[model samples]
Target chain A: MRKTFNNELSKMHVRFAEMGMMVHEAIFRAVKAFVDHDKALAHNVIVRDQAINECENELEKMTLEVIALYQPVTADLRDVITILKASSDIERIGDHAVSMCNATIRMKGSQRIAEIEVEIAKMGDYTCSMVEHVLDAYVNRNLERAYQIAKDDRFLDAELRKIRQRCMTVMQAAPASVFSGSYYISVATYLERIGDYVTNVCEWIVFLQLGEIVELNPSSKNNL
Target chain B: MKVKRIRIIRTFFSDAIIIFIFLTVIFLLVIRQVRNGSVSAWGVETFLLLSVTAIILAAVDIFGRYLRFRKRKQNLEALNSRLSNIIEGTKGKHVLLEPSDPYYELSQSINAVQSMKDMISKSFVTQQRGYFSLIEYLTIGVMVLDQDRKIYLSNHAMSDLIGREMNLKKQLYVNVLRTYELSQLIERVYQDRQDQHAEIKLDFSDKVVDAHVVYVPVSEHHFLVMALLYDITELKEIERMQMDFVGNVSHELKTPITAITGFSETLLQGALKDPKALKEFLNIIHQESLKLTELVEDILSLARIDASPELKLDEIDIRKFIINLLRPFRPEISKKDIHVEIQIPNGCTVQVDQNKLRHVINNLVQNAIKYNNYKGNVWLKGTIKKDSWFISVNDNGYGIPKDEKERIFERFYRVDTSRSRQNGGTGLGLSVVKEYVEAMSGKITVDSQVGVGSTFTVIFPLELPTAPLNESTK
Candidate 1:
């Protein structure tokens, strides 16, 4: 019976990893679509969001089943609970990827905001890396790495502030670009939100280890 | 020492009291005899006798009691020292006593208890040895950590995985496991008192380890965390290759299907009404469909070869086989004004499956003709070796680039897709040639230089095996 329980736990881990890769791909393509102004790629990213949600549901169900049948306590219980919560964070990141795509679709064939696009792209890269590292930390149970990722979210936060400033300056300098400028801001905001969710994942990693829910990014506390 | 002295004095005092009581009884008896006039006389001689006897008897009684007290005192001292030695964790012998000794029964009981302890401890040591040996020989890496995240135990596999011998006892887990991911996993198990799991790529080595961390509750208040590492680098590589294959296949199929659908849609929309343009559009559709057909057929043939690699052997005249294989490509060769040369010994025979060998020759010859420049030369040469027949196809065409030679046989791999498409070449032609050549107990290799020429040499076994060999062995 213990062996069967362990097998189920391993299966849950594999599912979570698969979900991580899927979300990573989605965010990557979503950012590329925005930068390249590819409507079809954006549409594909939007369509793929349902798969992420479905994967999240499947992971949650498996976690619940393991808890109910095994009635595991201590570390076993902590593992299941961590996966259950982390999957939701990952699913939210996937949603933000779709939002990124939606923002891309809104500003179809407009004058490219070169400076802001560059900033958003940087922010996108940071957010994707955060998602990847945090998931790895979760899977590996690397507490120190989880802590490092939590700290890295501060960098993304700073980048978000810089992007906001640039978007405002561009809009103020030229009124005609305000139409596309607002969409760029929305994209940046979505990326920042995605970074926040990644921070939440890093927090989950801390919780999984220490059984403590810590607010790792202090600056984001008021917003939360 | 004081207590023993007091005990001896107390024993002497009790003995003196018993003697005194005896003397009083004797005096009373004498007095009664004298008063009843039963004795002749109460004389000085009789009194002297009674007094001397009583004195002697008291002396002997006191002396015997002193000897017994001394013996018991010595026995008690020896037993006390031995018990103290045992309590202090020293190996001490049990005090030996004769059956007649005063403390013999106590000495026997102490010895019994000591031996029982020895037996229990020896069994425990043996069991511990067995447990450690079992873990040491296991193939999977195992590490145990205490609640403080200190390394308690590790096996041989753990050392191999870490790429070093580790003295892990009482050492913090992070100090031993260099990977941050693994250290954190151990910490998670320790803090949460639950089983955790992770896959870690090692920084010190190029190995991917799948770690399963589990919480072990030794008692109500004591627990340990165990991490098991399984190397999964090979599995990961296989998974990546499978994914790449799927991606490449889909991409390859999508292009032709898109072209066919798009061109046909253009024709149906209005181009068909324009008679002059209709023929050209129809021809493009037809060519794309043919390419698609060739691609599917190549894929199916590869699948068949993979599923069953057994070949049906037939003896073929080399000169005749070369002529028959090049017959279909003769028109193309002549159209391109390419010179064809066949240098095969007459009456020389090779054993192979006729149909599969035909496919191999057909692909090589077709590639030679299609890639040849105008008025270029194509050579088909056969030679006999000790155990094999070497067939070489030489083409003086725009030769393959140096870097692309190795990947030319990969499915759907084209160095220049537009050029190949314009020349009506399906990208699967070389890959199919490679697969068929190998399926017939042969090996294929290419020698090419850009702007010079290419020679594709296929070496077939002189005699194909009569019985099927295991596919994997080949």
Candidate 2:
């Protein structure tokens, strides 16, 4: 029975890594679309988000199935629960990358302010790398790296705020540039939102290890 | 193991009890004979009793002495404790037990032998340590798995190659080596017991390694599989880039040459009499010829550099250099109506090959002009950074795709095929720019966003790197 549980868990692990890879590719391609202005890659990331969402639902079902079957206690229970929570957060991350792709699609042919664009790109980079590191931390159960990634969320947030301020200035100074500037603002915001989801994944990792719910980035925002 | 010079034997208290009973029996018999006072010939009974007592006494003495000597050496723990002190070079242990003791000489010999074994084993351990360190410090990753497929040993390089902590021992190789390709390769090696070589991808990242696994047999029943992994990710990347270059060269050559041949063949067959067709065909021929010349010139330049690439370095002010480089682009810049902004600090200078730098700067400036939207802004900022100096060419134009970003420097790689062809780009622009930058001991990086624009930065170091240059020199 223990072997059965372990095998199920290993299968889940492989699935989870696959989902992580998919999300990673989505984030990468989404950023590429934003950077390269490739609508096809943007549409691809958008289409791929459905698969990611399905992955999350499937992951949730697997966890519930493990709970129904083994009714595991302590660490075993923590493992299933953490994965369930973290996979949801990853789905959210994929969703936000989709939002960036949506923003990329909408921003088409509008004038781009370089200053705001660079900040938005910076946010994309931070989001891409954080998702990568956070997934690794979860797989390796590296609490220190998870904590470092939690700290990294603040940088993404700062870039988001900075881009918003810059976009506001661009909007006021040149009303003509506001169309693409607002899209840039939205893209940065989505990246920051992705960073929040990454922090939540970090929280699940901590809960998996420490066996208690703890917030690595305790923010008053994202309350909704 | 050292052969024992002295044999070991142990006697128990039960043997002492049996000996006591036999001596008592002899005493009783003697007592019975004496008490009975049998009338025998003179002193015959007396002589017999005396001989019996003397024989028994001699037997007991020999047995007791042998037991005492053997018993002293019986405790292996005592011998180990004695030898440990000697091996440690401590003064507490004596080579010879107290000289007054009956078995002191025998103990001395055993102690001498014990110390000799200790020295030999100690040296063996040090030699083994040396071999272990050799594997530990090897640049190529090495792992040895026993027949059970457990990781018998792995080095630091192994961990670095896989980008994981794998210093653990006796772990199943599959558990440590996450990639299916690597694990399957190891399994194959174990099954065939033959040497195998492969290029395996690390699943998480695009890291490639040249893997060589050897089946090492220790005995009939025992064997090991040794895997040597050297990271060839960079090498594979260069190989791919060169392959793209070669493939592009053929494709680039074929297109215009085919157009030239077809147009000329059409003119030769029938169209010569029709002035309109003649003029059109000749124009087509002329255009294709121009393209052919451009391609040939680009190819020859690359070949010249490939033959013996040299750098002639000189110090030039950055702001002045950029403005001068932008000289050729002024007419195109105005035609595109680009808002060219140069924010390089005055007196900012670098030592670089002048002609090569001119080519590098010109390629970037021309790209900025070609790819920009009407009234698009071109920003050039020169900054002297620690360890390196850089000038970034930032443009508000259609940016490169993320996937194609890595390949953009490859010859004939165009993000937008139609746009580049429309713009009359040979696709060799970035490739030549990259080559010249590397030849001048520099680096280049591009950051771009789809609709937003692109930034191309050419960086040169403050100090020459001691290590050799990249794939070009090789």
The best candidate in terms of DockQ: 2
TM-score of 1: 0.40
Off by over 4 Å in 1: A1-224, B1-134, B137-140, B147-149, B160-172, B184-199, B207-225, B228-246, B270-283, B311-468, B471-474
DockQ for each of the predicted structures, in order?
0.02, 0.25
lDDT (0 to 1) per candidate:
0.78, 0.79
Name the 10 consecutive residues with the lowest summed lDDT in model 2 chain A: A215-224
- The CAPRI-style docking tier of model 1 reads incorrect
Model 2 over residues B300-380: C-alpha lDDT tens digits?
Answer: 777776676667779899999998888877788888889999999999877877898888888898888899899899999
- Stretches of candidate 2 off by over 4 Å are A1-62, A73-79, A98-113, A132-186, A202-219, A222-224, B1-205, B208-243, B262-284, B308-325, B342-357, B379-394, B399-409, B434-474
lDDT of 1 by residue, A1-224 (tens): 99999879867875677677678778877876776566788998899898889989999999999999999998888889988998998898899899989988988755445567657767877777677677667766789998888888777767777877887898899887788888887787788888888888888888888989888877764643
In model 2 chain B, where is the ten-residue run with the lowest total lDDT?
B1-10
CA lDDT, candidate 2, residue B61: 63
